[model samples]
Target: MNKSRIFRTLLGIAIVSAVPTLAHAQKANWQNLDLKSDSTFGISTEKAYKELLKGKKSVKVIVAVNDGGVEATHEDLKRIMWVNTKEKPGNGKDDDKNGYIDDINGWNFIGGPKESVNFETLELTRLVRRDQARFANTTDANVAEKDKKDFEAFKAERAELEQKLAEAKENLAGITGFKTALDAVVQKIGKENPTAEDFKNFKPSTAIEGRIQGILIQQLEKGSFKDFYEDQIKEGLDYYTRQAEYNLNLDYDPRSIVGDDPNNDKERFYGNNDVAGPDAMHGTHVAGIIAADRTNKIGILGVADNVAIMGVRCTPNGDERDKDVANAIRYAVDNGAKVINMSFGKAYSWNKAVVNEAMKYAASKDVLIVQAAGNENKNIDVENNFPNHKDLDEKTIASWITVGASGPKDDETLKASFSNYGKNQVDVFAPGVQIYSTVPGSKYKSLDGTSMASPVVAGLAGLIRSYYPKLTAAQVKEIIVKSVTKVNHNVEYAKGEGPDAEKVSVPFSDLCISGGIVNAYNALKLAATYSGKSVAK
Candidate 1:
């Protein structure tokens, strides 16, 4: 990454702690923070303390996380998780009549309340099957041409997946071998609970120690892979096992377990209320971000307080099918999830109509969908991404908002290098870069993506709704748009190996629709003035 760009982006900022100084206590108002201070360039979370987040109640709202399962029992996320009292745990009956049998908190659409796949591209498999069937036939001109194009696409995808699978397998093997050897060494050496670092520091008389040292050293250098351990290694094995079972083999009839045809539009009522799945980390983390209890000091503070996190596990490690997302939306809407946080997307969509109809369904229910503007650094205006409802039609959909990532520093580098952007495609920018929030396993970690940004905004919207409750979804959208901190400061652009690259600085306003970072404090404060009597608060 561009260290200088990052440094400049953060410019001058300090961490916000529990005890506030007099100067810290008296934070600049939002208007002043935007014009004079460079803190906005730096995400200004500390500045957010004084400027935006100080006086607000932890708004109670449930934001659905539709991604990989979260570590449900993480240290920081346990207290505030949503629970469904009506449904009995591990019951075979559909107690709620919501179609899902015993969904306690949320439902896993991929696993079907039973067996599911992992990290597999169902779309690629579909395309692959179609191509293979056509390749065998002496087809007509149009059929042959289409088949050729499809074959090329499939070939590329197959190559990528094969490489990824190979890598996963290799890594899995290495981890397994290392763990076995380490286990033997630890037994002989009379040690236990040795971290990778501990193993590295200790000198052993065996070749296994040297190999372990090499792996540990390599891991330490990467920084991002530091969390690896024997247990994590075993988890990796499970991941690969599922990958082999569901994704690679393409045995995607998981719906039979739930006793519903996933492909059939009318057969939507089958899943049970087993929200936690065998594992429920992803949805839990996403839920915690929206409504984990604040100031509990147990795990982490969520953006909103009063939400009932409705877990809808539609995403696996790979591409989520159109049907899953569509049905997930309908489920959340039907079950009273007012704000849906979709931190997932895919490159290829076989049935746009299914997703589009789901989007409309959510809209008609007066639910707002906060979708992540994908993580590719490229501009999305040129390329069409699946699950995007508004950009395709000339007519606009007001219920959906596409969020882009912004770093803590409020400058050009503020825009996350990985976040996809388009002047018209993305709705606004928010603090998605280096965001500290809840993760799986009852833990908290700082993740960076437009995925993080979407929920922050969703949480803010929930806050508005919690206090005002009567604010229409459209009105909430307007309130957020009108309440942004518009900045026109000159700053650097994307820093990487490319033409038109360098410190080619420009006005920050050119970057996004509002040209300003999201500030919950300002939005709520402004909305609070008009919130009287009109809203439910």
Candidate 2:
């Protein structure tokens, strides 16, 4: 997830992207299945329809996908897109005078008149660069009183930056060396593009040669793209290289392409209306999870019934700016989005106050914000995960939900291996493993992350709001939390940091506040009792 928060997941090299692999024409809706009959820990969506909502009616509910970007015109998404009614399409003028021209779909906070800012420096990298000029020449003794705290942060960031840079370079060397050896094996086989059969049948002279053949055979057998050299590993090479070159580079900056005043955080009306910005894979999948065309019967069915997806692009290839996130939330709320799915979070925040104020604004307007608990396996209670609900004093926000990833297993693997968990910070868990949903270009594939889980909950929230119009955002959150199907088993938990952390057995209830996977059937029943409204909107 986190097209906003990408990190290491590679063979031995620490790759920067958690790119979801392609699912070879998979049509299984395991996320919407039943636990008893299907043996899958799904949301009981199919059961909800047959048992409770068979003849019910629902009103339109707008669920804003505040993520990297979305394919608004995909075959499964075009019908349910949020169209800006007041603004005219293609006139080049702000017909609604909302400062964004021709915003027929939604606004893109990372875009400008001619282009969009695709990749940006992480908040850590930005901090290092911004403070390098003043702190590079000073030390603990010479730094001023007010600047002491900032100087300490700068030192920490600089050190972390150096370590990560070294690791990246080392990892890149390993990948390149592997490819060089792979080429040697291919040359010996006399095949330009070696197949599984070629690698399996060929005889190796040395032990190192046998190791290379074994690795290639394993990669090709994953059933992903067969060309491991060109498709899978090559993509990893390019991604990690770009991450090292741009995300970790202090000299590279893409903000100038957006034509914004760099010093100001108060500037709100800067980005253009390119809602589906450069890369739409991540956000498009999130949007499809909420509500693709369920009636079409051609592709897969979505989670909610009457959801209109509003794409508010903000997240980039690297960390998203706090200013963009704050503006994206405000834009969605002002434009009548009832539920916002923010499938992105970072390890640090440059300006939390602005985002806090925007969250408050959404709360004041009755817009519920759903966020991911990040992909790091560490407990967020000890580590930092931004865009959380707690204010400066640790007081919780009423209408916010922080989700963790749950899988199809019933035992130790119930929680996704890489999901971040917290009993206080994370609110609930949902299906996030091998989740089949829409990607770009009318295509479908299975992806993983709390990014996918968040939209499932958001879609449920939208469904509840659509059917029970009398329910408040806070009430919907309460019902969802209270109605989860609790887990009664202990699961393996990573007790510490680093790769070789000890695995301890802990009750699944201790992972998150809800202690279970979300159940849409139970939540709808709870909503009916709480609001004294059911079946119709």
**Per-model TM values vs. the true structure:** 0.72, 0.93
| Superposed Cα deviation of residue 184, candidate 1 (Å) | 14
Give the runs in model 1 whose Cα sits over 4 Å from its true position. 1-60, 70-79, 83-92, 113-119, 138-259, 390-396, 489-510, 529-537
**Residue range 13-84, candidate 2, lDDT tens digits:** 654333334443222788889898788789999899889998999889999999988898899999999999
Error of model 2, residue 476, in angstroms = 0.7
lDDT of each: 0.61, 0.83
lDDT of 1 at 177: 68
TM-score of candidate 2 against the unseen true structure? 0.93
Q: How many backbone clashes does every candidate have?
A: 40, 0
State the displacement of the C-alpha of residue 413, model 1, in Å, after optimal TM-score superposition. Answer: 2.3
lDDT of 1: 0.61
Residue pairs with backbone atoms closer than 3 Å in model 2 (clashes): none
